[model samples]
Target: MTTKPAINLWSSSDHAAEYLSRAESVPHRTEGESALLEFIPPSTRRILDLGTGDGRLLALVKGELSERLRSEGTSPRVEAVAVDFSPAMLEAAARRFAGDPSVTIKIHNLDYPLPDLGKFDAVVSCFAIHHVTHERKRALYAEIYSLLNPGGVFCNLEHVASPTERLHDEMLSHLDKTPETEDPSNKLLDVETQLQWLQEIGFADVDCHWKWREFALLAGRVGAS
Candidate 1:
């Protein structure tokens, strides 16, 4: 079998540190995250968070689910697995979920196939996955499909490609940067192509659920028997 490309930046300390420092300041991220939460079925039991930087998105999702369950007078618990390649990010996630028996943090690079962590009711990712090459992204989506239980949902709050070079430059300009400053790690793909890939992989109801410039929330669900 052929080996896969390694996730380089994710294993670097500086890359993980830089992302964590700016993670909260990304424009329209919270809105996209909230929209992602809305796509997940409230009855979801287990979750898998891919490229879970500092476990931010997973924390948000778990917190929301907790509140909803509390209000409904139900004792539903969400078991979660948060995966990342960076040691720094893994440490941060461990600290973030310290003493929380519900979350399990694992260190795994997205460049390779997902581990046999079992199936999940919902799988989520945020501002991650684009670091992998386009081919790997497609393959990873297939792996995600295989790991989801029937009727499970996949929600990704992602960074997508701009429609034109001018628009791409404009987005960078808004962030006070240029192409040179753009993360070489990003392998941005168009939203349409990604949605099509999900559908082709047998995910139903696939769509770009929310969009703000180049940031978007993509969602889909597997059919239940």
Candidate 2:
């Protein structure tokens, strides 16, 4: 029997638009996002947002860091780089960060190796990355590790695989989706395997910080020493 080829449809404008239209309604996602922010060190001065669709997560991180700094009476300007492959996403992200010299939006696909955009104090991704094959996911994690400054953190708010088919279907139902209606770009992996991969990649303090059904926040840090 011939195995069907893996497919990713995120490059299509219609698909990208459709996802953006409903991006806000993903259940318990805000809780997961809040959890992910706690891992970011207060001293972070630079950030990289991978697959930054509309710059939403980046905005939240930058805002949180700014607020934290302001409270301490030290406001060091934060710099951020937001990357995405889809033209529609890029456009939306550009609009979101417009006139903000702190954020730079770039076009890049996650299926290939990430470009050398310089090291980051913190690297983040949300509901992205899983668009690539499992092999690429592991490789991308390694690359993300390489891109981090020593002691920097990597936070990925992701859509992961449920352990059992029954749970997976149930998760879809919660999202008002069924298997046939879900995005074809999603190439879900189990959270346990992904957390293990982070540990194997030499990330210290690795763990799943938060999770609700198929949604999760996976984070780890480079050794501070």
Candidate 3:
């Protein structure tokens, strides 16, 4: 059954380690990440990375922003918060950013409402939001909208559902897995549905910014011009 898994394996070290070992090899992942970095404004001061698995995506965004600022001979400080519910993931992220005063790693489950971490100029998540139910997904988007600054952006590099079972099967084959063995925690929803949810939640410029097969980047802003 493609329904939600009865248990969340992500809390276990073995499951988190397995995913980390295979994380970089996901097809076109770098492409999607590059597109995500392009949308982040140069003036972004504070960032929140939801489900910050190993803090990889957050590292990329921070690196890009740092390099951009350095190129103009302007070095502005930036603050980052990396959040995940898994102890393994929290440990990995904390270690990755250790000794760096700019980043904070926090333990949080996306199934619940976001904590009062203050507003952010950009909120990002990569391949992590689909593990929650569809209802929570919408609510989380609403929460994200509320957490953003006036011109802030939310960019989610998500695992989305395909239109057909055949396509889904093909994608699984491409990843060298079957539905039987895939991560059962995924509560995949279509890109369009999520975009619509963002729009309905008062997001401006809601759209799918990029897509590669079952993977897509959904982006929306908090306020309009």
**In candidate 3, where is summed lDDT lowest over 10 consecutive residues?**
1-10
The TM-score between candidate 2 and the true structure equals 0.96
Q: Where does model 2 exceed 4 Å of error?
A: 1-4
lDDT of 1 by residue, 62-139 (tens): 998888999999977789999998899999999999999999999898988988999999999998988888889899
RMSD of each: 2.8, 1.9, 1.7
> How do the residues 51-158 of candidate 2 rate in per-residue lDDT, one tens digit apiece?
998889999999999999989999889999999989999999999888999998989988889988999999999999888888888999999999899889999999
The TM-scores of all predictions, comma-separated, are 0.95, 0.96, 0.96
Give the TM-score (vs. native) of candidate 1. Answer: 0.95
Assess each prediction's global lDDT (C-alpha) against the native: 0.89, 0.90, 0.91
The predicted structure with the larger lDDT, 1 or 2, is: 2
- List candidate 1 segments past 4 Å from native: 1-7
